[model samples]
Target: MSLNRIASVRAVLGISLTLVLATFFFSPSYSMESRDNSSSPVAGLRVEIKQTSTSPITITSTVVNDNDHTVTFLVYNSPLDTAAPSIGLLTITPDGASEPLDLPKLQIQRQWPPSPESLIQLQPGASQTADIVLKDFIASKIAGKASVALKGRWDMVWNKQKDDVTPEMIEQAQLQAEPDVFSGSFASESVEISPA
Candidate 1:
């Protein structure tokens, strides 16, 4: 590749890395249909959530890749809505409650190569974290309690199954997931975000 091309590639990758870290923080959360898997384990992936603030109710999510191989994730798309996004893809349960709070999900939409731009590849031992601020009704429910338990999940569907696929098409293959990628979910211990 020419020097210019290489530089651009590096720049893009750098931006992507930054975005992945901020995906949770900046990505606008809308009422869309995004799929969430049941609690399962894959390649030693771990997820955790914490309440960063109580004034407006802020929650942060951290995803760590413990596998030796690289894993890519589909950073979700934020719809038009820019209201208070309650939290990440985790289920919220009040302390001493049997079940978690109910929240709406977005529809699953996977474009082609262009879409994979939202995907982030995490190398072994690498982690990405982002936080969301909540001021909606959900925040009101969780306020004045002590702490609320949060559940976190990670799902992966690589873009390549059989070799022979082109270099450019690789990311798309993973983004599509197409039931080919192994999906797993795990719940995390609660963090104190609410105050009495």
Candidate 2:
């Protein structure tokens, strides 16, 4: 083929390839918003639990927000009046134990129609760590390897819509949000521990 003809063919191929890629990336089925809107927020978020000590079973749980927008959640704040709209009990299973130990129950005060100001923010790509207590639930614990995991439930609202929302309005909005009750679990790697 002549030099001019060859150059024209290459340009056409390049444009075609670019258009195909752009279409794929921008398509509704392949876009990020589509996934976030369709799936549970717990699936997008991640949790990692590390057994810091063996004797008392000191666990540090880290929660990661992988969504594109910021998320508002309740932290283990007062243990009394904290709003845990989307978190559930954690499960700890020893290597050979038949029954799993659950995290100690918190005296969570039920505030119907969650307070608008009590929510904590988790920015995109951010993570927060909180110390988890297992001593009360598993007293005189046997020393051995154990696996820790979190079975969490989350009620999430878009950051943009969460601000300035009133409790009265929240109840109705909760039903309309993308992910109202997202249930999922996070499994962490086993960590060695010894009785303190």
Candidate 3:
């Protein structure tokens, strides 16, 4: 082919390839918002639990927010309420057993939508941790066990709607606007622990 003809052919192929790539990458299925609304506040919230110490039988649990927006929610394993039994933080299952250890669950009596000030808000890409001392449940129960697996789950604690919100509730919270509750349960990978 002539030099001019070859150059025109190359330009056409380059333009076609660019359009195809842009269509593929920018499509709704590949967009960040499509994967469970990844741009939403609740997207990619992860929970992780690790055995910190054997003496006190402590477990360090962390909740990481991977989304771009802030998330507001509650955690039973709050630092202030460390002594209280968690609502649905960690579940302990022995290596060979089918049933999980009966860890006490804390029951709260509150209004439908929890107090705005009562909720915990985490910024985008930030993480919150609760170091739980499982001495009461683990030390005695899993004593001398070769290894025990632990799974941590964070459950959405509220069922309130936008209508249930009050004006004063918004003013009291750290979030200036009406906060969308980060709904859904996030579970961590099962971590194996060896107790002495």
Q: In terms of TM-score, which candidate is strongest?
A: 2
TM-score of 1: 0.53
Model 3 TM-score is: 0.55
Tens-digit per-residue lDDT, 69-169, candidate 1 = 66665445211112214334445667776786675554544555534455666677887776666656677667455444444333343433223233365
What are the runs in model 2 whose C-alpha is more than 4 Å off? 1-36, 53-56, 74-88, 102-108, 157-165, 173-194
Q: What does candidate 2's lDDT look like per residue over 58-125, in tens digits?
A: 66767777878776654323111112212335555667888875435546665667666555566889
By TM-score rank, best first, the candidates go: 2, 3, 1
lDDT of each: 0.54, 0.56, 0.57
Candidate 1's C-alpha lDDT?
0.54
Give per-residue lDDT, candidate 3, residue 82.
45
Model 1, position 151, has a per-residue lDDT of 41
List the lowest-lDDT window of 10 residues for candidate 3. 150-159
Output the worst ten-in-a-row residue range by lDDT, candidate 2.
77-86
In candidate 3, what are the lDDT values of residues 18-49, reduced to their tens digit?
Answer: 99999998997678446444334434667667
CA displacement after TM-score superposition, residue 78 of candidate 3 (Å): 8.3
What's the distance in Å from true for residue 134, model 3?
0.7
lDDT against true structure, model 3: 0.57
Root-mean-square deviation of Cα positions for candidate 1 versus the true structure, in angstroms: 20.7
